[model samples]
Target: MPQLPEDMVLPEGFVPSQAPQPPAEPRDSATVALVRDTDGGPEVFLLRRVLGMAFAGGMTVFPGGGVDKRDADTSVAWAGPTPAWWARAFGCSAELARALVCAAVRETFEEAGVLLAGPDADSVVADATPYADARQELVERKLSLAEFLTEAGLVLRADLLRPLGNWVTPPEEPRRYDTRFFLAALPTGQRADGSTTEADHAAWQRPQDAIADWAARRSGLMPPTWVTLSQLAEHRSVRELLAAERQITKITPRVVRRNGNLHVALPGDADYPEAS
Candidate 1:
């Protein structure tokens, strides 16, 4: 298990309750780690969420968000692995698997301006700048991913995504999410932008460098992001990283009190049993 920094402080408004309370249900969400091969190694795209956001405010994260209701639409033009295949991969129902995949693609576009869909099944959009208006509409909930793809005559390229893992927010958290993480190579010609209102800064950083930034206290990384970066740092190239087989499992880190301070404990930690 990866270790959290000793100086780490909980996010704003994340105070634990004084008395035991029922854990809030976690909302289904998707997150994508966009990557590209670099001379130095594989670099993953990350966005620093604006400090005022209710969830992971001021933390750097991959492009992703909650599954939109329309993301589960069966009418979405899709290519590559079927929802059933994805269902088996994530150990969820096919309907939810479809929604998760669609959410991954849609959120990637809305947050990063990178579209994984294409006009035809065999190709991906070379440039997404033309769909700026649609991106806004999607963000504003005025358009569903299926509606946008159908009108644009494109198919969601499921082949471009690979399941990374699933993480459920700890029950102690007032706001929680059952977030599925996916990895996608940055499309060849599409450039990612940080224009979304959710993030104040965006950039591509080599995974190890990101970990280093966290170590030096220059950037904030939640446990999931930190662990993902550590895992990515072990691979030498994008192909290697993607081709590496992953045994998808659910990892729910728990928050515990340790020596009068709050700490996050992974499954294997000694204090994990005390979490709640």
Candidate 2:
């Protein structure tokens, strides 16, 4: 578990008028850890969310968002692993597993300019730049992933994704998400563009380099991103990283008081290194 920051301090003379509101419902979402091998080491793609966003603003994170209703559209063309396979992998219902996989692929294309879909079960889009218009439509919610794939005759490559873990937002947050994390290799010939409106900038950085940036306060990383990078930093190549087995577990932070200061605590508090 990652270390949590101290609780916010309220201004003097500020009194609560009503009891605290319950935490927002946790929305079903998916995030992708897009990685590739480079001369230095394996690098992961990251996006700095626009500061004005409602959640995790200005934080470096993986490309992902809430699952769209259309993600569950069973008609979408798909190749590779079946929804049932993903269901078992993610411990989700088959129906939701389909939506999660679709959401993962869709969000990756919309946010990172990488399409995990191909013309057929075996062919992936060598270059995704040609589909900029479709990508925009998807971002705008004007185009459903199912519709885009059907019109373009593409198949969702579920085989390209590997489940890493799941995370649920802490109850203290006003907006929450039950997000699933996935690992995927950047497709051949496709370049990730940092053109999404939601992000001020995006790029690929080696795991250790990103951690160093965070330590220097040059980049902001949420607990999940920080911990994930730390784990990935141990691997020198994407192949080795992916070949390792991961036992997925859910981690939720809880409020605790220590030394007269309120702070969030996660599992293994005494041994867990602080990432905040």
Candidate 3:
């Protein structure tokens, strides 16, 4: 790893000062932890994004990504909470926050094959496989989030998502996301099985087990990911974790390079594992 200039600091995001505008570009993202109650404790879904992807490649992550422009539409029916409450949840403008949560739910549906919506979650997901396929195309700009949500008869469960954390990639990484993390219980009858193309594999694992694997170097986790999962392991139940989120007053994370590793410093001084 190369050492950063002692006096130089990188911007939080990248922008080409001079280049043709891209027809489509990556926006900041919102992601979530699909948690479920287990006798052992709260388990969360995890996916290993394909190594070929530009960002966070080959790493285990909770399902999530950037806000889609179509997510801004106010018409997306939400079953859980009001938009104002959602705004406060994600700590952004009401419109932007609503979009982030909506995108989170939508992305979860797209990536994990689980819907936090519909009258019957199991049936909704079963019926949604085709739309889910379309949402995947949205990533490639073949379709839009608005079209996917409307045509599929799916409601974006913005209320179900509880803001948990926010992180941005370090300066050195070419790809970055000012990502907001949300937490929600796994919708009943819906399971999180990831697509093999974008993700190598997926599973629902206890947060502690996930962290322990990372700490033991058994599972690959970047620094930010390591700490986030560790913090999630503190609570023994999903209800308790949800309660804890209500008391959260901050989600600012610091990106840095140390000891040959990129790190995301969270509140209380925890960090995700970065490469050396």
Give the best candidate by lDDT: 1
lDDT (C-alpha) at residue 58 in model 2: 89
lDDT at 29, model 1: 98
Off by over 4 Å in 1: 1-13, 274-276
Tens-digit lDDT string for candidate 1 (1-276): 456666665643366554238778899999999999999999999999999899988999999999888899999999999999999999999999999999999999999999999988899999999999999999999999999999999999999999998999988778899999999999989999967999999999999999899889899999899989988889999999889899899888887777777777888787787545
**Tens-digit lDDT track of model 2 for 192-253:** 98678899999899988988888777988777777788888888899998898887787765
For each candidate in the order shown, give its overall lDDT on alpha carbons.
0.91, 0.83, 0.68
List TM-score per model, in order: 0.96, 0.89, 0.76
Task: State the lDDT of candidate 3 residue by residue for 11-78, as single tens digits.
Answer: 33422333223313335788888899999999999998888687766779988877877778777756
How does model 1 score by TM-score?
0.96
Clashes of each: 0, 0, 8
Clashing pairs in 1: none
